[model samples]
Every structure is written in C-alpha cells, then in structure tokens.
Target: MNTPGTLYLIPTVLADDTAAQVLPPQVAERVAALSYFLVENARTARRFIKSVAPQQVIEELSLTVIDKDSTEAQIQAALHPVAAGQDAGVLSEAGCPGIADPGAELARRAHQLGLRVVPLVGPSSLLLALMASGMNGQSFAFHGYLPIERPRRVAALKQLEKQAISQHQTQLFIETPYRNQQLLDDLLATLQPGTRLCVAASLTAPTEYVRTDTIAGWRKQGAPQLHKQPAVFLIGA
Candidate 1:
C-alpha cells in the first residue's frame, strides 16, 4: 500500500508587504518545495511565489484553481496528486486556507483519502481582529458575510448582537470591500447603541485601522471611509 503524500494548507499574505513584515521565511520555503498547488488565483499565487523565491521556475509549477464555490469532484481532482504520493499545497487568495476558504474542501477530501494535512502558521485577519478587539476572545464566532438583502441583513445583525449580549461571545463577520461603509452604516443603525463594534480595516497594510467603540460612539465620530478597503468587523460583549 502506498502511503499518501501530505497536503499543506498554506496561508498567503494579507497585504503586499506582509511577506517581509509578517510572514516567516519558512512559509516561502515550504511553498517553494511543493510542485503541486491548488490556489484561489493562479496569477496571485504565482506572483506571491515569485516574490519570495525569485530563483524559482514559476512556469514549471502545477497550479490548480479552487475557490469557495468549487465542487466535490473538483476538490477530489485537486487532491489526486497527494493520494499518488506527491506533496500538494492549497493556497487561498489571502490569509490561511480551510478556515473560511473554499480550499477547505481540498483539505477535507485529503483527510478522507488518508493523506496527511499540514497547516502552516501565517496571518489571519479574523484572529488578529479578535486579539485586538478587547472583546470576548475566548468565545467567539466568525459569520463570514451577513445577508445582502436589507431586511435579512438587519435580522442577521440583530441575531448576532443577541448572541453577543446574551452569551458574551464575540460575533465576527465581513462585508464586500465596496460595501464596507454601507455595512458599517447598517451595523450602527441596527445594533443596540451600547453594543461594541470593532472595525479592523486594511489589516497588515500601510493604512491599517483598528478601533473598538460603542455603536453610539461610532455615530458621533461620523462614518469612516472603509469603501474598497479590505476589512474585518466584530460585534460582541
């Protein structure tokens, strides 16, 4: 019986300079060693690898595309190399894979096929936000993105707030970069005045912004320009 090769859940930088600022050298080392990779974006993955290993032959690497909406058959095909004893990597567009990423499907399939799953240490905007939010870090949840519809979105926000207030769990979520300011507006209008909101924007970037304040406090300061900026938001006790 052939022992299955490993599947590495690799994390990419959250921002342009994070390779130098936040990532350890081992991240590039491990990625460079793998010949097969499943990535959210081939261009970005190739760019990232090239940034870290200029000497690497980017043209020779086998890169497969996988996103949040990939199917089961697609996931199985991506992991086939791992089952055949070739170490493979799964890379998300940013941050760690298999958490909130579609690359998670590959990891799960790898496990079912008796492949070794290895996760590398790297920046996770969600965890970073929780760490600096001063909220209930020990107990928290990441809801990804709330509903797009106004009524449903408001309902979802209310539910998350209720959880935060009653269970003391931090409720974390994100919005489309373009709709970030709109989301903030909805958050302020929907959540209770006393509820705490942490807005962490452009994480690991030059223009990073992380602030925790009550909904009322936020309204007083006027709206921030979060449109088109990568951000993470948390609401909780």
Candidate 2:
C-alpha cells in the first residue's frame, strides 16, 4: 500500500484585490506544488492560483467541484487521488476552507480515510471581523447565516442578543451580500437598544469598514450602505 498524500485546506483572500497583502508566500508555494484541487468554483480557484503563481499553467491543474450539493460518493471519488499518493488541495470561494464553506465535508472524509489534512494560513473574514469588533472574543459563537424569512430572522436576532447578554458571549453571523442591508435593518429593529452591534464589511480590502456601536447609536447614525457587500454582524453585551 502506498503512503496517502496530504489534503491541504488552502485559504483564499477575502477580497479580490488583496491576495498579495493577505495570503503568505507559503500558500503560493503549496498551491504550486499540487496538481489536483477540489474547489467550490473552478473559475475563481484558477484565478486565485494564477494570482499567486503567475508561472503556473492553469490547464495543467485538475480542478474538481466539491460544492454544497456534492454527494458522499462524489467526495470519495475526489479523494481517490490523495489516497493513491497524489497530494490534493481544497479551495474555498473566499476565506478559509471548511469554516462556513462546503470544504468541511471533504476534510471530514479525508480524516475518515486516514489521510493527513493540513490547513494553510490565510485570511478569514469571520476572524478578522471578530478581532476588530471589540467584543468578547474568549466566548464567541459563529452562526453561519440567519433565517431568511423576516419572522424567523427577527426571532433569531432576539435569541442571539439574549445569548450575548446572558453569557457575555459575542454572537456572530453573516447574510447573503444582497440581503446584508435587510439583515442589518432587522438586527436594529430586533435587538435591544443597549446591545452592541458590529458590522464589518469588505474586510481586508481598501474599502474595509468595521464599526461597533450600541443599537441606539447605530439608529442615530443611520443604516450603512451594506446592500451588496460581504459583511459580518456581531451582537455583544
């Protein structure tokens, strides 16, 4: 039996133009060494690889799609090369793979097959947002996305606020870019006026914005232009 090759959990830049500033040189080195990759989007993954290693031939790399809808058998097939001693990488559409991304399933399968799983350092919007939020970092919870419906979303926000106040924990969540403004509106309406709300948008980019203020303060300042920007929302005591 051949030694199983490693499965690298590669991280990508949070913003399109901040790759050089956010990703370390080691990320490029590791990506250049691998020929097989499982990515959420092949086009973006190819673009990211090209940005890091300009000399790399994109056509030579085998990019496989392992998205939210990927089945168990499909994931198993994607890992076949790694199990046969060919190193493979998993890339997310943005930030670190396996966090809120579908790459987690692949990593879980890799562990089940006894293959080595190594995570490469890179920018994660969630961590960056929390780091700058001035919230209770030691006790924080990340809820990937809130309910889409108005009633459910409002209920979820109220619950998150309750948790933050009772446990002194920072409750973090994200919304689809297009629905960012709607979520913010709901948050302001649902959370208590004294609760602290943080909206971190376009992190790691030149237009990055991070602000933490009480609900009343936010209302006074008016809603930010978060209509279609990548953002993270946090509720804290």
Q: Which candidate is the best by lDDT?
A: 2
lDDT by residue for model 1 over 95-202, one digit each (tens)?
999878887788788889888999998999999999989999889999998899989999999999999999999999998899998899899999888999999999
Model 2: pairs clashing at backbone N, Cα or C within 3 Å: none
Q: How would you encode candidate 2's per-residue C-alpha lDDT over 1-237 as one tens digit per residue?
A: 899999999999988788789888899999889899999999999998999988889988899999999999999999999999999999999999999999999999999999999999999898999999999999999999899999988988889999999999999999999999999988888888999999999999888999999999999998889988999999999
Mind sharing the TM-score for model 2? 0.99
- lDDT for model 2, please: 0.94
Candidate 2 off by > 4 Å: none
Query: How high is the CA lDDT of each candidate model?
Result: 0.89, 0.94
Best by TM-score: 2
TM-score of every candidate relative to the true structure: 0.97, 0.99
The true-versus-predicted C-alpha distance at residue 62 of model 2, in Å, is: 0.8
Which residue runs of candidate 1 sit more than 4 Å off their true CA positions?
none
